[model samples]
Target: MKTVPIQIALPEDEYADQLAFLKKWDDGPKPPGWELTPKAVVVFICGGSGLRLENNQRMDIAPKFIGDRSLVERCVVTLAGARGLLLVGEPGTAKSMLSELLSAAICGTSALTVQGSAGTTEDQLRYGWNYGMLLAEGPSEKALVPSPVLSAMRAGKVARIEEITRCQPEIQDSLVPVLSERRIAVPELGDYSVPAREGFCVIATANLRDRGVSEMSAALKRRFNFEHVDPIADKKAEVALVKSRTQRAIADAQALIDVDDAVVDTLVTIFKDLRSGITEEGWSVAKPTTVMSTAEAVAISTSISLAAAYFPDSGAQLALIPGHILGAVRKDDEKDTERIIAYFDKAIQRRANANPNSPWAILWDNRHGIS
Candidate 1:
C-alpha cells in the first residue's frame, strides 16, 4: 500500500531561499540565537525594494508588515532584551502576522506558539501532566508535559502567544515569574526549574475588541514592552494589498476572475468612510462599531473574486460590494446596518451622481440588495 505525505512547513522553512540570500548579504553582528542580523531582519519584514546584491544584481524582498520600518525595528530590539514583546491593536491589523514574521526571522521556526483564549488553561502556558506516565512513574520528569513556552525557554527560541487578553487575567499572570526570573518552576518534579537559555522571548498579541478579555495585571504589563499595530492609513497601499491578496486567492482557487482595480478602489473607499465616520469629500457619515480593517478588505475582495468565479457570467455585475459589506458591518451592532444604509444615501449615491459611469455609481446601483 502506498501512503501520501503531507508537508507543512513554517515561514522560515518555506522562505529558506530568501533567508539564505539575506544571510549572504548581511555581515552585521546578530544577537545570540538570531537567524539574521538586525538590518537583515528589517529587510525581511519591510521589503528590500530595489536592493543591490554583491554582484550588483537587483533584489526585491517581499514585505510582510506594511507599516513603519522603525516600528518593526523596535519590536525586534525588544525581544533581544529582557522584556517580552506585547502587540496591541484593533483586530485584523496584522499583529499576528508581524509576530510570526518576527519569530521566523529571529528563531528560524515560527511553530513554538500558544494561542490564548478564554478557555486557555494554565497548563497550556506552563506545563501539564501525562496521566499515564504519572500513574506509572509517580511525579517523575517523564510524566511532565512540556508546553510551547517551556520548550522555547529550554531551546532559547521565540515563542508566540496570540490574543493574550482573551485569556483570564489570573491565567495570564502565570508568565510574570517565567519572564522576570527567566525560568519555569515545576514543583511536582521536586521543584524542577527550566532555565531560559539566551535569546528566549515571548511575543504576545492583544486585540482591542476581543471578547471576554480581562484587563492585564499591572505587574504583568511591566514585564512586557507594548507596541501598537495600527491599520494601514494609505489608500493606494491598502488597495495594492487587497489586489495582491485577492489575486493570490483567485490563483489558489484556480479561479480566472480578474478583480477590477476600480472595484477594489471603491470597496476600500467605502471601508475607510465607514471606519472614520467621514467621507473622502468631507461628509459626516455615522461610523459602524464593527472593525472595517484592511484585512477585511482583502477578505471581501477575495470573496468577490471567488463569487465571480463560481457564478456563470457574474463578472459583468461585480458591483455587489454593498451587499458584501452589509454582511461585514453588522457583526458587533445591529444598529450599524442603519449607518451603512445612511452611507449609501448620503455619500456613495452622491459620488455616483457626481462621477457618472464610474464604479461608484455601479456600486450605488447594486445598493438595493444591501438591506
Candidate 2:
C-alpha cells in the first residue's frame, strides 16, 4: 500500500532545508539546547535579505510571520532567558503560527504540543499513566506516560500550548510549578521528579476574544512574558499574504486556476472595511461581531479560486466575493448579516458606482447573495 502525504506538514518538517541552512549560515553563540542563534531565529521568522555563505552560495530566508521584528526578538529573548512566552491576539492573527515557527527554530522539532480546550485535563499538561502497565507494574517508570510538556522537559526542547484560554482555569494552572520551578513532581513515585533540562521552555497562545472562558491566575500570568500579535496593518502586506496563502491553498487542491490579484485585493478591502468598521476613504461602517482577519481573507480568496477552478461556469471570481464574505461574517451573530448588508448598501454601492470597471462592481452586482 502506498503511503499518502499529510494534508498539512509541520513547520519543522516543511522547512527542514531552511533550518539546516541556518544552522550552517550562523555559527554564532547559541543559548543552551538551542538549534539556531537568536539572530538566526529572528531571520527565520521575519526574513532577511539574500546572504552569501562561506561556500559562495546564496540563500534567501523567506519571511514566515508578517509582523514586527522587535516582537519576534522579544519572543526569542524570553525563550533564551528560560521564561514562558505567552502570545495573545485575535483569533486569526497567526498567534499559533508564530508559536510553531519559534519552537521549530529554537528546537529541532515542533511536535511537542498541547492543544488547550474546554475538555483539556491536567494529565495532558503534566503526565499520565498507561492503565494496563500501571495495573501490572504499579507506579514505575514503565507505567508512566509522558505528556508533550514532560517530553519537552526531558528532551530539553520547546513545547507549545495552543488556545490556552480555552482550557479550564484549574487545568491551566497545572503549569505553575513547571514554569516557576522548572520541574514536575511525581507524587506517585516517592522522591522522583522530572527536572526540565537547560533550554526547556514553553510558548503558549490565547485568543483575546476567549478571555472570559478561563482567565490565567496571577501566579501563572507572572511566570510568562506576554506578547501581543496584532493583525497586519499594511494593506499591501495583507494583500500579498492573502494572495500567497491563497495560491498555496489552491496548489494544495491540485487546481490549475491562476489567482486573480484584483479579486484578492477586492476581497481583502471588504474584509478590512468590515473588520475595522471604517472604509479606506474615512467613512464609518458597521463592524461585524466576528473577526475579519487576514487568515479568513486568505480562506475566502482560496475558496473563490477553487470554485472558479472546479466550476468554470460559476461566473467571474469577483462575483463569488460577496457570498463568501456573508458566510464568513455570519458565524457568531445573526445581526452581522444586517451589518454586512448595510456595508454593501453604503460602502460597496458607492465603490461600484464610482468605478464600473472595478471588481467592486461585480461584488455589488452579486450583493443579493448576502440576503
Task: Give the top-scoring candidate (lDDT).
Answer: 2
Q: Model 2: residues >4 Å from true position, as ranges?
A: none
- Every model: Cα RMSD to truth: 2.0, 1.0
- What lDDT is obtained when candidate 1 is compared to the true structure? 0.86
Q: In model 1, which regions exceed 4 Å deviation?
A: 1-9, 50-58, 211-214, 315-317
| Ten contiguous residues minimizing lDDT sum, candidate 1 | 312-321
Q: lDDT of each model, Cα atoms only? A: 0.86, 0.92
User: Candidate 1, after superposition: displacement of residue 166 in Å?
Assistant: 0.7
For residues 1-371, could you state the per-residue lDDT of candidate 2 as single tens digits?
Answer: 99997998999899998889899899999999999999999998999888667997778988999989999999999999999999998889999899999999999888899999999999999999999988887899878899999999999999999999899988989999999999999999998999999889999999989864236888889999999999998999999999999999998999999999998888888888888888999999999999999999998999989999999999898888888988998899999999999999999899999999888888889988999
**Clash list (residue pairs), candidate 1:** none
Candidate of highest TM-score = 2
Residue 263 lDDT (model 2)? 89
Q: Write the per-residue lDDT of candidate 1 for residues 19-94, one digit (tens) a residue.
A: 8788777877989878788889889989887777688866799887898889999998898775799999999999
TM-score between model 2 and native: 0.98
